[model samples]
Target: MKRAALVPEFTVPSPERLPDMWPGREVELDGLKAYVRDTPAAAPGAEPAVYVHGLGGSSTNWTDLAGVLAGRLDGQAIDLPGFGYSDPARSYSLAAMASHIVRWVEHSGRGPVHLFGNSMGGAAVVVAAALRPDLVRSLTLISPAMPFLDPRRSLQGPIVPLLLLPNAAKLAARRMSSMEPEALASMVIESCYADPTRYPEQRRLEAIEEARRRHLVPWYAEAYVGSLRGLVSSFLRAYLPGEGSMWKMAARIKAPTLVIAGRQDRLVDIRTAPQVARLIPDSRLMMLEGVGHVAQMEVPRTVARAVFGMLDELQEDKAGRAATQQVATQVRDGVRQRAPRVRMAS
Candidate 1:
């Protein structure tokens, strides 16, 4: 396949530029307001991409990954409604989250973008891609919280029962509220990373600060609980035969996709990664050793390389098609020119 000269291949050097977390601000679009942070690309005419965080995560979760890929992709990471700095929405279901992503892409006119998601955010983008294929160019899922029929084996098992309780989110929120910010941050780091020590001290401080700020939000509990319940419901529907199944939705995705799984992910099962890759027609899988649920955070450079490789291949595919079409046109033109002109006797 011919390689396109449209852009030079992107590479990340050791100690790649890790800029401070991109400045964030509230942005309202299509009547939905979200806290968005933009990471500008150094590469000219770099394609645009959007990052969606998992449950309980904010846009800041993508800081390091986006930073390393800045030369290749201009990135925007949004705070899903009810998480981060975004205000609560009427619903925190998967469908609602997917719709918000679609609306944002439509309103911004950044269609056919490279869409990324992690954990619950991963599930949301799958729906978004299936719903509006024209709006998505490619997909990258890192430890996506796909449907797990049995949560009993994972860290999520304990939280599953909350779905049955009355105002469970509210109740959990009250408990979480009393915990110190540092403690909450520690708990999160422990759960999300294979090696909590790898977590940068600066980011840890940021996480602690976010925990403190979240306590002030009236809807924090509602958002967390609502989103979790919605995720579990999707899991049930995915196994039953129907259009609601996440597996079916994944199979319907038209964009090229890359699924990354951490071997030590305590939240999402690594076994499901293969199933997800097989279901998506144009997809590849990467399983990282000794990595946890958040590979993007644990190994940003590695993830960036895989992402850039996909883009490079996509460019080559386009070039190959163009070359083939050109040759066919030329052959047809040559044959026409060589053939004797035909005319009726006058």
Candidate 2:
């Protein structure tokens, strides 16, 4: 049986911005708003990194990681359609989200980019990279929601969608709203972190306050349902083996890959990490002990190091390959030039 806590032990912080910390370009399209930040490439040939967030999450979830990664490489993070400040769309699916990312990449004119995602967002990166290998130079997945047979162990499978059900979701929202801001904040931390005590009280309160405000919107139920439906459907399709599922496509991924998982995650079990590492041929896995579902949020520095480390490796690999090709071409040209001289001497 799964363990359930009646009350959270820590205090939640109030929701307030620290000012210009998460400032970025805001693009509005089809009623959705995408918050994008661009960090120029550190080196002429360095590829930019693009980040996508998971379900019920906003780009803010990646604020810390983005700031750290931006210093090392060109980076960007966006709120997927219908989540965060982004407006709702008619449909939500991994493929649909991947398509949106492709457009974003093309519009940014960043050339090829390194991709990173958490949970559902991680799955989206995988699908996007598979669809357009030329546009993606490498991939870093933090607790990617791949195919899993056990529904009880996967948050994306059933529990999330159940919470999104019209009446049930509204009831849940109401219940959460009724709690004190501090209590609500504590609940959010409990759900988000394996060790909620590690998070600052202010951050937790801010998250709870945001949830409280969102609950007041009349169409919040509709948005919740749409988002959950898309996630559950995608989760199903990605898990079925021999179904041309996303897991099957993982083998086709040629980009250097890095998958990070939190051993203490209650939402998506850590057992999925090794399988993911095995499927992607050129991939490595980094499991963090005493962490939860949102490792990026829970331990930003560690996540940043693992993710940027992979980006560095990819850059080095590309440089090495380019040099090898250049040398091979020169050697071939020299052999051709000497062929006629050798024939005449003979």
- Please give the RMSD to the true structure for each candidate, in Å: 3.2, 7.3
| Residue 109 lDDT in candidate 1 | 85
Candidate maximizing TM-score = 1
Q: Per-residue lDDT of 1-31 in model 2, one digit per residue for the tens?
A: 0111111212112225432336567886444
Scored by CA lDDT, what does every candidate get?
0.88, 0.71
Alpha-carbon error at 135 in model 1, in Å?
A: 0.5
* Clashes per model (N, Cα, C within 3 A): 1, 9
Model 2 TM? 0.82
TM-scores for all candidates: the values are 0.94, 0.82
lDDT of 1 by residue, 231-270 (tens): 9989899989889999999999999999998899989988
